[model samples]
Target chain A: MAYVKINKDRCKGCGLCIQNCKLALLVIVEDELNVLGYHPVGFVDGEGECKGCKFCAETCPDCAIEVYK
Target chain B: MTTEAKDKPKKVYGRPESLKDVGFHFCPGCNHGNVHKMVAEAIDEFGVREKTIGVAGVGCGVFLYNYIDIDVLEAPHGRACAEATGVSRVHPDHVVFTYQGDGDLAAIGIAETIHAANRGEHITVLFVNNTVYGMTGGQMAPTTLLGQKTTTSPYGREFMGEGYPIKMAEMLATLEGTAFVARVACNTPKNIMAAKRAIKKAFKMQIDKMGFTFVEILSACPTNWGMDAVTANKRVEEEMIPYFPLGILKERTTADYL
Candidate 1:
């Protein structure tokens, strides 16, 4: 059972987490331009390859990201 | 879908979910950021973000609610302890902590801090002592040592003109109600690790329903110190350490705990 989990609803677009990720694993998914408006960033790919560093999860201005090793 | 990507959010350890989406108002090299990060880390490690109430001081960190994700209560320039007393009483089960600077805690609020620690209030105080008043321009503070120059004491602080710096941790250790009293600096990676340990223990003491626990962190204020960020860090090692020797002043473990 991993302890980290990212709450997608609360994710903000700040990339501080991306800066801190040493393993080069996190990429931001910008708003895809839905019918209503722009949306917050989401994990682009490599969800399973997370080293569980929690760097992005920790530095995220929003508690939108989670991690469990 | 590849780990080879250049941009990746590292697995940030010790991140908690209770913090909301807000940055901080501290300076670029201020130690408040480190303290805030450590508090959040401890909250995450202990799983107490939901039940932790952070009381912010009225110094440079007056707007600390911006960074920390928990429920932060802002206190007047020197009234964090008084406010924490009320908050802790209201929410006994919650972990209450206060983040304050030397001027806010050791100077203007010294009386409040002493009384609160003396009263054995079940709260943790994260005290950052940069040895000078950081906000409202640098000035001679109660923790400013002899010979150290400040805006108010450009010719070096005269013992006759300015009283000696207050050894807050030593003073508070005599109160008897204080459960943990440790001093750690943030001058290097080793000190950073030590600071983390002190922070973790302070949080744990509060969890065990212990009395007052105070961690004095020797921090740097490059802007106020009239030096660059790097110099400020080295000053903590060369100058500050000689005066305020770092170590666990008082610990209550088992035999000591009893």
Candidate 2:
């Protein structure tokens, strides 16, 4: 199993990570707003489902995602 | 205690050391942030942060100094190349580079860029070509494609009125003094990786005392393009790449200089 941490305040809610994740394990929390007043992305299954591919981290333009294996 | 300890995963990927901890001012999904990371990664890999000097031009990329943890100088609009030329000449041992936008490099600063490259100044130029003048509210730029609309050209760019989009990398490649020139994009993972390599190579070229090196990154301007970040990235892959083909337009050898 792998884990991903997102710097919520730094996220812009662009969803690039969501689109890039091949596992479809990421989602944007539309109900919650970050300090920047935008919805930030989160993992659907937390650490359980992530495969540590780092596709989300690689595609995050804001450098908001940190993945660990 | 054992359960808690087992839950933590080792840190694998994070921000580069050469970049500062401050949040970027660029809009969400903007390519500047990614490019900045690539530049910082190159600096970190080469272990040249202390001896690196960055020259920033006026535009969205003007705040590059705020993100990059290195000595940086702010140059007047379209004068980054000129300023970098001076800095590289004065501090020959230090690595000097300029960060510029399409309008700053290809339009107003074209003369400085051409002359600097023509003179074979040992410096690196990171040029971002987003097709429009993003900082000043999406005005048409020299790289703006025909039929692409902008605030200044709301009715779509016309060939007769606006002329053709400038092919900067191709044009610079023909110059005798340029040692390396390549055009890359930041739209996809593969392309972004390629861009990082090109950026690193450009810096390496400067460290090797090769002539002027240039890397033009085709970036996305979602706000200006009136699209979401994903769509803007798609546009770069679909529209921009076709117009500005990717690859090394030129690479000079010792024989050419001799």
Candidate 3:
């Protein structure tokens, strides 16, 4: 199983992580605005089946995402 | 969080210790943040945080000192290489590097950068090429694509009025003093990994007293490009990569020198 943490305050909601998430596990939480006034990315573990590829983390420009496996 | 769970789950990715606990001021999805993280990771991996001196150039990257926790000297517009030269000369044992934007390195500071590289100064240079002058509100830069439109070139860059984009990597590779030169991007996961490798090698070459090292990062200026972060990233992969062609342009080994 894998887990990911998205620092809400630091997220710029650029959606780069979501675009790179191969599993389509990341989504922009439009309903929730971050401290920066942009919608931040939310991670859906999807039955805890993350591949732990770290693609989302690596592609994040804001360094908002942290991944653990 | 329990200690057991913390120990059980291996952290795959997180902020490097070399990076300060502060959010970047770059626009959403700006490539500078990714590049900064890669640099910090390189510094951490090499354990050179204390010995590293970062020379920040004018432009958006001027605030590099704020992000990376290290001794940083803010150089005047386009003088990062010149200042880095002095820093490296003073402390030959320290790791000296300069972070510069396209406008700073390719435009105003071109002479300083070229001269430093020509002299084979033992320093590393991190050049971020986003095509336009991002900090100055998206002006036409020397590296701007011929047809690209910017605040300065509203009618689109015409070949007659503006020359073709300068290929800094190829230009620097022709210099005899340079030990390594490579072009990388931060648009995708695979590309980011490649960028990290290039940056690490650049620093390593400097540490080994090889000569001047350069890593040209084809970054994205989403706000200046007037595109969303994702679209701007696509532009880097689809447009910029075609012109910049990523890879190592030059590498000098001891065997070649001897």
lDDT by residue (B1-258, candidate 2, tens digit) is 698788878888889999898889889889999999999999999999999999999899999888999999999989999999999999999999999999999999999999999999999999999999999999999999999999999999999998999999999999988999999998888888899999999999899898999999999999999999999999998999999999999887652565
Q: Write the per-residue lDDT of candidate 3 for residues B49-110, one digit (tens) a residue.
A: 99999999999998988999999999999999999999999999999999999999999999
What TM-score does chain A reach in every model? 0.62, 0.91, 0.93
Candidate 2 ranges beyond 4 A from true positions: B1-8, B255-258
Worst 10 residues of 2 chain B by lDDT: B249-258
TM-score for candidate 3: 0.97
For model 3, what share of native contacts is present? 0.94
Candidate 1 per-residue lDDT over residues B90-171, each given as its tens digit: 9999999999998899888999999999888889998989988898798988999789888999998987978888899999
> Backbone collision count in every prediction?
18, 0, 0
- In CAPRI terms, model 2 is classed as medium
Each prediction's whole-model lDDT (CA): 0.75, 0.92, 0.93
In model 3, state the lDDT of residue B226. Answer: 99
Check candidate 3 and list the clashing pairs: none
Instruction: Output the better candidate (1/3) by TM-score.
Output: 3
Write the residue-wise lDDT of candidate 3 on A1-69 in tens digits: 788989999999899988998889999888998778988889887688788899999988878888888
Count clashing residue pairs in model 2: 0
